[model samples]
Target: MTFDRPHDLLKRSPANPLIVPEQVRPSRPDWRVDCAFNAGVVQVGDETIMLVRVAESVAASAPGELRVPLLAEDGAGWRCTVESLRRDDPAYDFADPRMVVLRADPAQVYLTSMSHLRLARSTNGTDFTIDDAPFLFPSTRYERFGCEDARITAIEGRFYINYTAVSDLGIATGLAVTDDFRRVERLGLIFSPDNRDVCLFPRRIGGEYWCLHRPAPRHLGTPEIWIARSPDLLHWGRHERLAGAVPGGWEASKIGGGAPMLETDRGWLQIYHGVDAQQRYSLGALLLDLDDPRIVRARLGRPLARPAEPYEVTGFFDNVLFTCGATIRDDALYVYYGAADRVMALGTVALPELWAAMGV
Candidate 1:
């Protein structure tokens, strides 16, 4: 499938990138924000609440030196430690701007930056006010590397958040819920290593809770969207593939769940991201059977949105548009997306237009 930067059908906010790295204050004085994006958004009362991922680089060091932040095992727990390594050390490789790898031991890869979730508040859903400190910082051994991209699912009177936890152990998924954004109750690691991009359904179905997750492949099989159910929110089982990538298609490389599924009259509307051969990220829609979510009722043949504008085409990782959460207001679907994994932006489409786009 030829992408050629397919134009997104939604109407973008004139404000465009509503939130940037500079607008946020790093948790530590020595750290500087690299990028702030991939926020999990929700509408609470009259304000739009956003939990944005903010990745920061350590302060510059002496000439020829590199500072590597690590979580060292401290007896029964872990503690933050910074190690200094020569930039030109023969034992290390820094080809990728995202990380530094020990040449002889690739598994000893270290991120050049650490990410934390920041809370931002908006009244009109466009302009935002970012908090001075990180809303959610990496503290557990599982999140030694950092806590990144979060997806929110509001159920009952509380908000359920499933986020990616990065560590040397492996990329995994964790769960946390909040009554107010101020304090949270962590449920620890919900999905094992090499699994992420998780979203919990807003409500229970068939007297059980459901979630969408992506389990990565190391040696065999391809990365695809999968579904799981749980009696209690902490444990998940009964896993099955919900959607897979299409070879030579728009989603030829891989596909993963995006915003939590939106319930409609016809089915559960799910927004997901697709990566092509060039690693370009775009958005698509999948309508799942209302009663049986495992059944895919209809799918959007083309991307609902793709990297087109300057923001989407350039940044830390170019040609990417990713959304962790979306909300509906006055029949309009508000899509909060991250541009090139660098900044946060918003787009909107009428519910009717989206339904027609998917031909459902």
Candidate 2:
């Protein structure tokens, strides 16, 4: 609760990972995005865009054999192999730094984590530019195994975006609207598999349309947070499971809801992240029901931020903290996370007074 901010807003970025891939695969290496992500801010004419969530990964030398090699134009440059992989299948599972459950073939798996939706820009909220192509890729078929953590609300006039799609027919929830992020307007595979961190509740209540999801139950427990209903935020429904897992503290190993929830006044604040009992990762706060956002009027046993810096204690997946986007403006909020999955940083705190010191 003492997070005051500024010390250069948690320093250390001697260009740390900054943006990888000069050559890995034909050309699209890895931008890696899952947590500490962002999307939708837009002003365009004046500045402040931010669409990030790259995650590309495709490199191989000859060692274990999982290819993505390319570069055959015939004008001279050639490598070939286009695509051909196998990490032993069985719904796949290769762990260590590159973490890939890719579902080798539960019946038709097709995800290997390649997401794409880049572009950073910024004019007054610290320096940034990014964008070398990719405003959203992996086109259709529930993202063909790409796209992750995207939030971005805006509503009514466009800019919906609710992400995390993965493939092989699992881990769903996808939608895309966009206004000027160039173009995006997919809205496929609403919510399936074990679901994902959703959000989407930036207006509309009694009239329907609400979101916030999670649903990862397969051993029965943790990964809670649900709630549905929609007159058309893309069909939705009355689902409702709403928050769980605060039981013995720091989220007892499950908790979600980050970004796009924030309504204020004293409810619908939500800035979740929890996961403890050694899974580390923090940041919490909840206060729903701005007209039944699934009730849960207040909760925040601890953690408004944790993972005590070192660029969030090491990278490419270390003791991470994760966020996926945030942006309040004036009184400060900013928060953009994604440190240990390797890179992307910018944190801030001050709005709703960090949710009344998390006793919200």
- Specify the highest-TM-score model's number: 1
TM-scores, all candidates, are: 0.96, 0.30
> Candidate 2 on 256-307: residue-level lDDT in tens?
7777776766777767687877776666667886877778877755566676
**lDDT by residue for model 1 (1-360), tens:** 233655677778899999988898988888789899999998899999999999987777889988877678889987777778888898888788888888774458898888889899989999899999887888899899889999988887899888999998899999999999999888899999999989788788999999889999999999999999999888999999999999896699999998987887888888899998889898888899878899999998888888887888888988899999888899888889999889998888898888887887
lDDT of 2 at 329: 64
**List of clashing residue pairs for candidate 1:** none
Write down the worst ten-residue block by lDDT for model 1.
1-10
lDDT of each: 0.88, 0.63
Q: What is the lDDT of residue 62 in candidate 2?
A: 50
Maximum-lDDT candidate:
1
Q: What does candidate 2 score on TM?
A: 0.30
Model 1 has a clash total of 0
